[model samples]
Target: MNTDIEIVTGFLGSGKTSFINALVESTLVDNEKVLIIQCERGLREIQKTIIEDKRVKIKLYDAEKPLTEEYLKYALTLYRPHRVIIEHNGTRNLIETLNIFNSKALKKHCKITTIFYISEASVFNFYLDNMGGFLLPAVEYSNLILINNINEVGKEEIDKIHKKIDSINPYAIIIGVKKGESIKAMVQKEKILEEGFLKKLRIFFKNIVYR
Candidate 1:
């Protein structure tokens, strides 16, 4: 069976870990095994239930120890997870991180199914202003763009975020998620990927240029 890979990207304190917790608890089906590879440490803690779940496994990699295709292949051979979620480093270049998938060994072992970009509403513009190079490309490539901490901001602010993201990636499914909101149900209800051949073709070329 082909392992399904999903990538989550966001700046520090953007609630990327929290979103993964929600997906594991609410979106994933019963009896499914998953491996979560965290590339960056975040402020939020993984829930205890998730830590204890036998079906879930977590791995951490950082500057001292980096991810490699050989290690990834070994992990797949050992745990043999049905799905893999990679929490990408927020400051790193997304295009470079994506090159990991181009490896022949990884290509045979897994396929990327979704790319999610999460941002805290209050800090979205602030980060964009300082780190637009990192943030903009992530927005353009994501299949789902989640604006978290929506409850903390007003409608005008929320609308501004929506408008800005839409301008960058009209095909992406953008949603505002309030604190403690059930993202699993909402995200599962949407059509996550571009449906038609023409749109997929556009995305293919966009990715080529992006790389």
Candidate 2:
């Protein structure tokens, strides 16, 4: 069986980092190694926090200016991970990134099992309005849609958001694929429930810096 490669792709404040943090905490058993191929420069604060506290085995890479096909090829050849989960830079062309990943250099090393397009719950409607432009492009660009922060957005908004995303692509995985507030919750050593203005600012900075 081909090892699953879950690529989390999204725009700023879209919640890719949180989703991965959730997956890591849930799926990664003690000592079971997982590689996080981060397409960001230097150390991201949230990622660092997860490293400091979480007991799970992880390999984090900044990818310099941003890891390209060559960098991915290098990682695959060097790391040889059994299961690879890449968190794509939101600003990058993920379709093209996947295409490059399938290049002769790295195709044998990895096969994309699923692509999660992580985004904000509040912005779902706005994205849908631009379906022909941004929404459709993002939808067509991914295999699954993960609407985050369901707790804050509540069931009613979540339902509407699901309809909006599904209307664009009925074939896409809508609900179970939905990854929410778990990112921040999972990363915390103490598991704090507090999400304040600073939290929003953190997310905003993360999106812009990573964008």
Candidate 3:
């Protein structure tokens, strides 16, 4: 089976590590062997439980070196993971990073399942104003856009962010995670709902065709 790749892009202190922790603790299956590759060390550390889990392996790389297909192939050979989660550096260009997965060498071994762009609600505008160059591409290509620390920001600001995201990537699933909420649980619920809706639509079409 080809290993699934999940990319989580966010700035430092934007809760990316915490979200990854939730994914490992609650979302992933018990039997799944996961390889987490961190582009750089963030302010928050990975949860201890994840570090102790034999099913999960962690690797850190220098953000300056940039991720390459050669490194991915090496990781695949070494860890033999069922799934790979890349905690991408927010400052890096996502398009360049995504291109590595499209290379012929790594294409057969792994495929990208989801690209999640995480942002801190309180500093959403600040980042947009200062780092639009780095942030825009990530938002445009991401499958899911998660806004953290929503409770700390006002509804007006959140609405503005939503409008901006919709303009950039209308198809993206945007979710606001409030304080004390589980990011993995929320995202999993959204995925389940989307799958359920698609299944119902397929049945409806089948009935129409048969009738």
lDDT: which candidate is best? 3
Clashing pairs in 3: none
Compared to the true structure, candidate 2 yields what TM-score?
Answer: 0.65
* Candidate lDDT values, in order: 0.79, 0.60, 0.82
Which candidate do you rate higher for lDDT, 1 or 2?
1
Query: On residues 22-89, what C-alpha lDDT tens digit does candidate 2 reach at each position?
Result: 66654543323356776742233345655765342355566445557786666656654445777777
Ranked by lDDT, top first: 3, 1, 2
The reply for model 3, stretches above 4 Å from the true place, is: 188-211
Show how many residue pairs clash in every candidate, following the order shown: 0, 0, 0
TM-score of each: 0.81, 0.65, 0.85
Q: What C-alpha lDDT does candidate 2 achieve relative to the native structure?
A: 0.60
What is candidate 3's CA lDDT for residue 1? 50
The TM-score of predicted model 1 comes to 0.81
State in Å the error of residue 133, model 1: 1.9
